[model samples]
Target chain A: MRLLREAAVIAGKDLRIEARSRVTTNQVLPFGGLVIVLFAMALDADRPTLTRVAPGLFWVTILLAASLAAARSAAVEIENGAADGLRMSSLDGASIFLGKAAAVAVQLVGLELVLGVAVVALYDVEVRSSPVMIVGALCATVGLAAAGTLFAALASGLRARETVLPLLLLPVLAPVLLGGTRAWEAGFEGTPSDGWPWVQLLALFGLVYGSLGVLAYGSLLEES
Target chain B: MLAGVDLDVVEGEIVLLSGPNGAGKTSLLRLLSGLLALTSGEANVLGHDLAVDRRSVRTQLALLGHDTFCYDDLSVVDNLRFAARAVGRSKHAAVEAADRAVERVGLARQAHLEHRRLSAGQKRRLSLGTALVRDARLLLLDEPHAGLDPEGRDVLDALVRDAASDGRTVVFSSHELDRARGLAGREVRIVAGEAHGGRFPTAAAASPTTSTSGSGSVSSAADEPVAGVSAARAGVDTEMAPGDAHEVSP
Candidate 1:
């Protein structure tokens, strides 16, 4: 309970910063929207082709947006050597990871909502199981944010962090991308039963990465 | 790069850590604060072994370095309150400590301004205020006077002096000997990553129980400055990042 409280404090700090900066509203949200527009335009005026590929395109946008959000989350910590204060403070390292991941997960959820609407309006894709879609999204967001926060810690202080972070994070995220896309595909196909299994995969992915973050973030924070 | 320099300070003692840049003054401070692990040495800080209990050491001590450690997006009060909560203070206590620190450091006028909007001197004061918020038994400050105006420096002096009077240990580094000499009960000079000790006439004002271990030795004499003591020369270390100025661990 105490650890969760500490994590909440960290998450609160991050969300408050995001609210003040509106980096998501001004930069990341627009970037996700633009990516969807670009994907729609690049696929060449074929309505069926665009609709068929919307699930994949939607997950792709989420992955890209999540990467950006995760990077920003890490940047917030290192800015002005604030991480040093944290390192020297009494907050637990696992709490830092959980809080940052929670913040990123929250941001990604907001982005997903905006982009989900964009995919439906732009690509003419129809959703089937609303519950499956929401559950899959939550699970995948957790997994992505967990892995993203973990990798961000690894890349925080190294030179070439911009180029290096996605390199470190993207490959690890392949499973989340795959699992999320498949689950959403099942939703688009109007098969809730088919999607439920994929949701489980996403949940499992989230659990594995979240647990790893809680276990290893302290050592990683110290090493970084 | 600290080579076999072991130094100890009992509770509530003010020790001046003096050295030219690149001589490992900052590195030693970070190591003691557990920001950087000791490469090969034994260190006990406030009853916790540095090797096994860094978290406890960090909890008991606060370090103010070149980095003010404020979030640019947050207001001054928010930053302090966040720090207070982070260091495990209760929510009510966190707010109380933050408000007190704001008043103590003379930042109450600018409490609502974002940290990035503050002037450099104001930012320095905010950093000092951050130190004030923590109920730490040990305070580690790295060049607390650099770039401060007279008023800012005065706030820092009061903070340090008050902490010492309240029985808190303080270790700070500075290039100005005259300013620092008056504040520290004892002085430890680091040359080539080795520490040499001395005493001040005001040593009697507080009880500084010290012992030497590893390859470092202590020589205490009231009114005798540490050997090779002089005005601190401004220096820099290319090997260490300016942010973690004294972090020299493998």
Candidate 2:
């Protein structure tokens, strides 16, 4: 109960701060949209080809936007001198991680929803099974958000945050991208999901990263 | 092993940890606070073994290091509210506590402003206020007065005194011996890895049951400084009382 309360507090503060500075969402949304637009222009006027690639394009946008959104979620905390204050509050580091991850997850989900709508409207993509694909996309994004927020905090303390973030983040997030892409591919093919294995893989990635990140955050915050 | 190095702090005792630079004062404090891993000996803080229940110990204690931990991008009030939430408070309580803390630190007027916009003195004061609001039983402050003006120092001094008075154990490390002397209820001197014995001169003012383990001596009375100590250079490891500074190799 206490942990949840603390987590809520941390999450609440994060949401409030994000509300105050909508730059996090504003930056991610346009960037994701541009990626979708660029792909549309490059893929030629082939409707069937675009439909075939639709799930791939949609999930790609989700992956990029989710990673970017989650990365900036913790970036704001460290940049503002808020991380240390959070450390001193005597709250468990895991609670802090969970809170931040949850907020980032919310942002990712919101972004994915927008991207999902945009994909269907602009790309003329056929939705074979809407519900499962949406759930899979969200689950995969949450997994990425969990992992990305942690690495973001780690990178934020480093010397070159912008340069270091993607380097540290990409290798770790490779599993997320792979799993999300594979699952979306399976979904688009209208085949029985070999995607189930990848969905399970994403869940594992989320749990491992979430737990480890929370455990490691306290010691990291101790670093100069 | 350094003789007479074992030490303990009970509630309501303002233990002023004094040592020259490199005296392992901060290291010792960190070890006690569970921020640093111990080399060998076990430490138990607030009934939780440091090795066994470090997490629980962390939940109960608050640490204020030289780093004025605050998020520069967030408003002063938001920072405090985040801290309150981390400690398991509701949003409403967090806001209330933050408001009170900002007021207490004289940052209420600037509460809505970003932390990065604040001056150095304001930042330090803000950090101190956050520590106070947590109301943790054990408070670890490293160089608590660094970067503060005289007026800010006085405000901090009062806060420290009040914490000790209210039965909160505060172990603060400082190079400012005069400031330590003014605020500390009991003075602890560390040289290298060794803890030198010093009398609780102010014990008579409150508790008279102060005692030392091993061959350490206890001083009587409040006004007198700890007798004739060698003066060690700053950052040198030495075990000596407040007035007496001794040097020892680790």
Candidate 3:
């Protein structure tokens, strides 16, 4: 219970800071929207092809935005030496991991919503499996956040963090991309049953990364 | 970047760490506060082994570094409140503590202002207030007087003295020899990653015109008087205060 409360406090602090800064809303969200528009342009308004690739395109846009959002979240702590203050505070490492991942997950969810609408409108896609699509997005966001938070911490001390974060995070998040895309494809194709297996894969991926983050964050935090 | 450094600080003792730039004073303080990992040394703080129980050690201490450790977008009071909550204070208690800390640092008027809007001195005061709000046993301050005005520096001295009077340990790094000479009970000089301890000329030693009790409450004696000498010789009476449990051990 105490750990949960601490995690809530951390999450609340991150969300409040982001709300005040409007970085995610003003900057990252627009970037995600632009990615969708670019994807449509790349397909040359080929309606059938766009519809078929909409699920992959949507998840791709989210993953791209997730990288930026995660980096920004970690940057907030690194700026002003807040990371050291966090290390000195009494909160446990697991709580910090949970809080940071949750914040990223929240931001990604918001981006996914905007991107989801874009894919449907621009790609002429229909949500035949709404439930499965929601579940797939939820599981994929958790996995992306978990892996992104870990890699963000890894790259935070580097001088090239902005550039290096994507390099480190993208490889680790390949499974999330694959599983999310496959599940969304099934959902868009009106086959919810086929999507459940990919949803499970995404869920499992989230669990593994989430657990790893909780256990490893303390050591990572202690490192110079 | 620190090596072969061994130092011990007792409860209620204000130890000033003086060193040149890159002398590892800040690194040593970070090591003690459990922010940096010890490569191959045994260390314990506040009854917790730093290598094995870092979280507990961190909880028992506060560190004020060059960075303000505040979100630029959050209000001054919000920053303190968030820090209080981070240290496991309840929400209600965090709000109360934050309010008191803001008032203590003389930032009540600027409490609602976003942190980025505050001037350098006000930001430093707010940072000090963040540390003040935590119930940590140890305070690790790095260059704490950098952006402070004369009044702010005095408030910092009083706050440090008050905290020591309440039996907490303070280890701060500073380069201002004359100003720091007055506040610290003992001055530890760090050179080439090594720490050497020596007694500063106490207020009593510098001037015999004034005598103060051992409680360390005499703010005017900051430059010339020492309070813990008697307590150190006789040993701090932890039985008188339940919160001072660390002094009983070692």
Which of candidates 1 and 3 is the stronger one according to DockQ?
1
Each candidate's fnat: 0.80, 0.54, 0.82
Residue-level lDDT for B121 in candidate 2:
87
Candidate 3 residue-wise lDDT at A59: 79
Question: What tens digits encode model 2's per-residue C-alpha lDDT throughout B1-250?
Answer: 1223445454566777777775556655555555554333444556555545555656567777766666666788888876776676667987899998898878878889877789988988888877866778778888888888998888888888888788667778788898778788667887654466554544446322222222221222222211111111122222343333234322
- Per-residue alpha-carbon lDDT of candidate 3 for residues B1-250, written as tens digits (9 for 90 to 100): 4533445555567888887776667666666666655555455566555546666767767888788989888999999999998888889999999999998999999999999999999999999998988877778788899999999999999999999899777889899878997999888776545555522344333421111112111111233221111111011231333223222321
lDDT of 2 at A165: 77
Interface root mean square deviation per prediction: 0.9, 2.9, 1.1
- Displacement of residue B53 (Cα, Å) in model 3 is 3.8
Scored by lDDT, model 2 comes in at 0.67
Best by DockQ: 1
Please name the candidate that would achieve the greatest TM-score relative to the true structure. 1
Off by over 4 Å in 1: B198-212, B215-250
- For candidate 2, give the lDDT of residue A77: 63
lDDT by residue (A56-78, candidate 1, tens digit) is 89998899898899999989888
Query: Candidate 1's error at B206, in angstroms?
Result: 12
Per-residue lDDT value at B79 in model 1: 95
Residue A84 C-alpha lDDT in model 1: 83
